[model samples]
Target chain A: MATYPRDLQYTREHEWARIEDDVIRVGITAYAVEQLGDVTLVDMPAPGEDVQAHERFGDIESVKTVSELFAPVSGEVVDVNTDLESSPELVNEGPYEDGWLVTIRPSDQAELDGLMDAAKYEEYLGTLDG
Target chain B: MSEALRETSLTDEHRALGARLVPFAGWRMPVQYEGIKKEHEAVRTRAGLFDVSHMGEILVEGPQAVAAVDRLVTNDVSKLTTGKALYTACCNEQGHILDDLIVYRLEDEKVLVVCNASNRDKIVGHFAQNLSLGTPWNDVSDAWALLALQGPHALATMKDLGAPPSLLELPYFSVTRASLGGVDLWAARTGYTGEDGFEFFCASEDAVALWRALIEAGTCHGLQPVGLGARDTLRLEARLMLYGNDITEETHPLEAGLGWVVKLDAGDFIGRDALRAIKGAGLGRKLVGFEMTGRGIARHGYPIVANGEPVGEVTSGSPGPTVGRNIGLGYVPLALAKVGTTLGIEIRGKVVDAMVVRTPFYKR
Candidate 1:
């Protein structure tokens, strides 16, 4: 069973977003990490870059494959996790906490409503298993 | 799908340890236990056991076996002493590699040919049509089980299992008969992880007992069970060539950076003249390793470009757990195969900067 938080919104691609005021904390879901295996590299987006919702912001490289990291919502990247360049394994160690990828100030706050909630995300993951 | 794919003798053991099972080479093999990186690290630092029964094993014996096998393979089989293993590529008349295999000389008249599981039928058919004129060829793939106990602590684990006295004297690429827990076994001092280890060949019925015994014996030595996923990544990190991925029926051994295994002047064999012609004509492209300096990985079939011109395509690539970077192998033009050559890999329409690096992206 994967950990699913009720407080966060998720994209179909398995990225999670926690909205705080106008900024959203972005990271990959626990299920995503489990699917990707051990993460070796996380290419972070540059701060101040504008990223579109559901578009590729960066990539997460694992032992066997490389997966594109998508933005959960349309936003301007305000902060990028610089710590991941040297310790990419942190994503696998603490996916929901210390492994947060970026902080984004959404271009439109209404985008959060369009994303899936905790229950829906879990259901989505179940569908993926089949 | 085929009972979730056939389980190995250690399948239950892997699940007991919380392993992630995945399909590999037509078997339900464990892809990881704790994780690929951790399991790989355990093998490098201590020891790791691998269930490799999916590898095909064919037994060739009889009086005409020597000459028959020699003419079928690229390497000189006559020079092999009993209990010695030689790695070589079996090629067709066109000099293209059919499959890479390990030929174990068990006796003057008996030989064991280990080939990739996916190519088992093809290889056996090749032998039947080409070399089994009067020799007895037995496809023992279903009757035998193969296990690889690899890494630095492999010797200690073998000692704990009451390995034969001949084991201590076994050098690299050597095989010896040994008794473990009263079961007769063939132990070969060879592995794919670029570490010191042994491969055990035994009856399928005794596989579970031997695996359990080895695990029990290796517990104190930090030996862990590894899977096919890590097996591939580890071998790639060591610059070891995989048959289907790195070299195929359309690829020559020399083009795949395996020229050392091709002994041209030895004797008459299949593809000898073609290989000699390629040697004299000079290779157009050669396989080389590359490290990604930009975002994304260089995956298989990804185009390699140098100075805006396409040079080759990546044959293998992954984020190396041990090396902490995206590394890959590809066939590039001869001029661009040199170390430190700058190139680019096209991934999803984006060209990522890469540099040709020396082989074995990870070093112990």
Candidate 2:
């Protein structure tokens, strides 16, 4: 069974968002990391770049395949995880704590309500199994 | 399409250990146990076990066995002594490759030929047609099971299992019969991982027992059961040629960078004349390795470009486990195949910079 934190919001594409004041911490879900075996490389967006919600922001390359990282909330990228360049496996090791991908300051705080909660995301994943 | 996927003798054992099963070459095989990189590291640093029964084996025995096999393969089979194995390719009359196989000379009159499982029927049909004039051939793939024990610590693991001293002295590409845990078996010092390892051949019924015995013996030395996903990554890291991916019917040995394996000066074989001509005229495009210099991953069928013109396409690509970088193999013009040449790979409508590098992308 996959674990989901009740405090975080999730997107349909398996990205997680945790809002802190005006900034939001984003990373991939545990299910996403399990799907992509071992991570080898991470392509991060620039710190100053503006990204749209549900749009491709970067790429994550695993030993078996490559997957695009999508932004869970619309915001300006304030900071990108530079540690992932040399230690990409951390995403697989700690998807919630140390594996955070980026911090973004959303233009509107109301966008958080549009994302799915833990219970809803778990239910969404159940539909995919069938 | 509803036909059930074939299972190896170790299928239940693999599932018991929590392996992810996937369909490979029409068989339900393990893709990974813990993880590909972790299992690959275990094989590089320690030892790893592999269930390789999916490979096909054929038996050839008769008065004209040597002559019959020599006419069908590209290698000099007549020079092989007993208990020796030679890697070679079988070609058609039109100089196209049928399949690459390993020929084991068990005795002066008997030989064992191992081929890819997907091409078993085709190879058997070709053998029957070409060697029908003499030599009796039979398919023995169903009766035998193949297992690989590979790594740097393989010898120690074998010794711990009470293997005979003679087994330790077997040189590379040599085979000998030995007993392990009271079971008689044929052990060959051959492998595809470019490491010092042994391949064990035994009866199909005895496979599960042998696997359990080895795993029990290897427990203290960090031996784990590996899957086909790690097998492919390891072979690619060693730059070993895979038939359907690196070499195919449309590609010749020379073009696939396997010219050293072809013995053209040793007299006439099936494709000797065409290979001789190819050797003399030189090759046009050659297989080469490359590492990504940009952000994106290069995948199979991605267009390769040099100086704004398309040169070739990637045949195999992945983010290598050991190298910690994106690497791939592709066919490029002969001149650009040299190491350090800059190239480009188109990824998602954008060109990503790449550079040609020497193969065996990862070295321990």
Candidate 3:
């Protein structure tokens, strides 16, 4: 019953990316929030930092555990979410919209094609339930 | 890997209630229902129910029960009257804690020992080795389920759930036999949260019925089901020592601020000589409560630094829900353990400012 928008491409690590022009807007999926319970802190990388695909960018800490955030595509960080510094719960409330984690200017735009679309991601998530 | 996690009797009930399950101490238990913060607040202001069935229970009965238990723990249990419970710890020959537990003297010859779920087998084995032959002891963990109803509204909630006046009138650290909605059980006025609450022990078969009945009765009083996530924060805020995290086999009771429970004059226990020797030799390091003065949540295994050198390590740390501050406990040099002593916690490779503060950060 978790929502997966058709406009966003997904990573196996549960990050979602929406490509606009040459930049990809990134955020964690709603399913990740459900799995994390309540997020207490979000450690985001600074803007202008270069990130490689499938590498750890930062960490998200819940009350019980901490999870590493992985970059879904290779890119230079264009912008980071400043709003999360005060209200980490935004990731639980509006993970897709207002809780967008970062904006990345793609180093190679071809990486978007390698990611899974909404239908494919939803199917991938179903396999995890088993 | 997925099949390794063990489930409690209420696993199905927790799933039905939309609880987010997490693996804790080898058991797949509910970490939160709606959310941790909300459930934590409910326990402070109203009432909260917790499925502590993971806690292990052992029953010891015989003429020598008191003497047998007295010889194992640091505290003297011989003076405990029937229906009263005392908190104590079992220790190794070196006087280091093996596990902290609560022993309830149900009768003159019968005592119930409650221990952490993770140390169930170890503690039972420890007892088996020391207990004299012909002394009857049984591990009743699998036969019973434990539930905690905690908060200011807990007493009223129990009353509404058909608990007898006798059970309701029982003072703290006291136990009484009672019937809740026709289910016979033992209710003890003891809880981990620093609140007026009661812990109920009933047969495993009656767990579902008892839980639902309490929930249905507590609905009007604002009772929510709490998970182990909040349980940790609640206990930390109250300065209660968690066996594995806060107190361990390497740490002695005196340095952990639990010297009060260790009775040196009470005579011949397993760790008496070692504890006596420790009392004579001044402590090198002491576990002290601290508050984060800078921005960061200091977590377990974080180093406590002083003068750019590692002094000690953090045992437990979290954002205290009631206090609205980031608080933690850690071991520090005896000089640095005093209140107002400034220390640093190395969090994520950066040192964060922290100060040693008075304990029980959220006292009622």
Candidate 4:
């Protein structure tokens, strides 16, 4: 079974958000990585770019297909992970930690509350298989 | 409405091995087991087994089988001896490719035509429409299960599994009959991956037993059960043209870098006239290999650009694990198909720099 950390909030699109003070750390869930097989390349948004909740900021391509990375909450991009440039497999190895895609200072902190909690996300993932 | 997906005889075995199954070309098949990269590497260095039963096979047998097959395929099938196979393509009247396939001359009166799974029905119908009356033809695709054992160490693994040591003496594209675990198998010294290996065809009922036997015997050689994902990458690294992705009904055989298989002087075939005309007029667009000098992998259907304008489309592109470079195949105008030609691939909207290079991206 893929790990779903209890502390992180999740999106229906399979993105995870760790809510910090004014910024939210974002990455794709482990389930997404497993589904994508081998992660070949990642195209991440640059810092200072404006992103909206539920909008596509970038994409991650696997050998079989391309999946767009959706923003769980709207914010200004504070930092983008440059480590993924040379080592995109980090996303497949550590989707929750070193694989984190971006940090965004939330334009509206209330958006995090609308995201699903770990338990709800796991239940959502279960429903998908059925 | 779409047709219901079909399952191979080894579907249960694939599930038991923890394969991630997906729908492909009207069949439920394994996309990967552990990972595409690991499986791909295993085939490059060690040995990897693939359940390629989804590939279709048709048997043609008659006094005039050779004549009918010669009229259908581009290659000179008349040159094939018993137990020899020839890689060729079946084309339309327009000289466009219908499907690329391998023809095995099992005997003087018997021939086996292996085709892509998606084009099986179309090819069967194509033969029916063209073959002479009373010619014996049978679509025995479901009667056998296909397995490809590939890698540098593949031959060693086969010998360990009771295969005769003399099997190694068989030339490439030759077939020999063998028995393992009391099951008769047709072992062909051929493979899609650019490696010394063999493809085995056995009765469908004996699939699980043969798969288990091979797995148990291959443990010492690091033989892993591979999936379609790795199969695609491995073939791409070798620059093997895929039927749907690389060659299509609209793509002529010569333009797809398959001119070697077309023997115009051999004899008359279905598309000979059109192909002869094309040979005289020269090609307008040619398929060429390219490498990404910029970041990101150029995917299928991505537009190829020259001097800031769209000139062609990428047919196959991926991160070649064996070649250790992001390589791709695309059709470019004859003027831009030359080696060292600078081209750009529009990835996600931005054009990325790429350069045309010599093909067969991975050399063993």
For candidate 1, the share of real interface contacts preserved is 0.86
True contacts kept of each: 0.86, 0.86, 0.50, 0.86
Candidate 2 lDDT, tens digit per residue, B141-201? 8888999999988898999999889998888898877888666778889888867899998
* TM-score values for chain B across all models: 0.96, 0.96, 0.98, 0.98
Candidate 4 interface RMSD value: 1.0
Could you tell me how far off, in angstroms, the CA of residue B186 lies in candidate 3 after the best superposition?
0.8
| RMSD of every prediction | 2.2, 2.4, 1.6, 1.0
Per-residue error (Å), model 2, residue B180: 1.8
Candidate 4 lDDT tens digits, B1-364:
8788899999999999999999888899999999999999999999999999999998899988888898899999988888999999899999999999999988889998999999989999999998878889998889989988899888777778777766767789998788865678888988999888888889899888889888887879999999999999999988999988899998999999899999999978999999999989999999999999998798899999999999999999988988888999999999999999999999989999999999889878
Query: In candidate 3, residue B360 scores what lDDT?
Result: 92
DockQ of each: 0.71, 0.68, 0.63, 0.84
Cα-based lDDT at residue A47, candidate 2 = 92
* Candidate 3 vs. true structure, TM-score: 0.96
Give per-residue CA lDDT, model 1, range B83-142, as digits (tens): 899999999999999999999988778899999987988999998888846788899988
Query: So what's the TM-score on candidate 2?
Result: 0.92
Q: Which regions of candidate 2 fall more than 4 Å away from where they truly are?
A: A106-114, A127-130, B1-3, B293-296, B323-325, B361-364
lDDT of 2 at B223: 93
lDDT of candidate 3 over A1-100, digit per residue (tens): 5799999999999999998887999999989988887788888889999999999999898776779999998889999999998988889889999889
Q: lDDT tens digits, residues B1-364, model 3?
A: 5558877778898999889887877899999998888899999999999999999999999999988898999998988899999999889999999999999998889999999998999999999998878889999998999999999999888889777788889999998888996778889999999888999899999998889898988989999999998999999999999988889999999999999889889968998999999989889999999999987888999999999999999999988879988899999999898899999999888899999999999998
lDDT of 1 at B36: 87
Model 3 pairs whose backbones collide? none
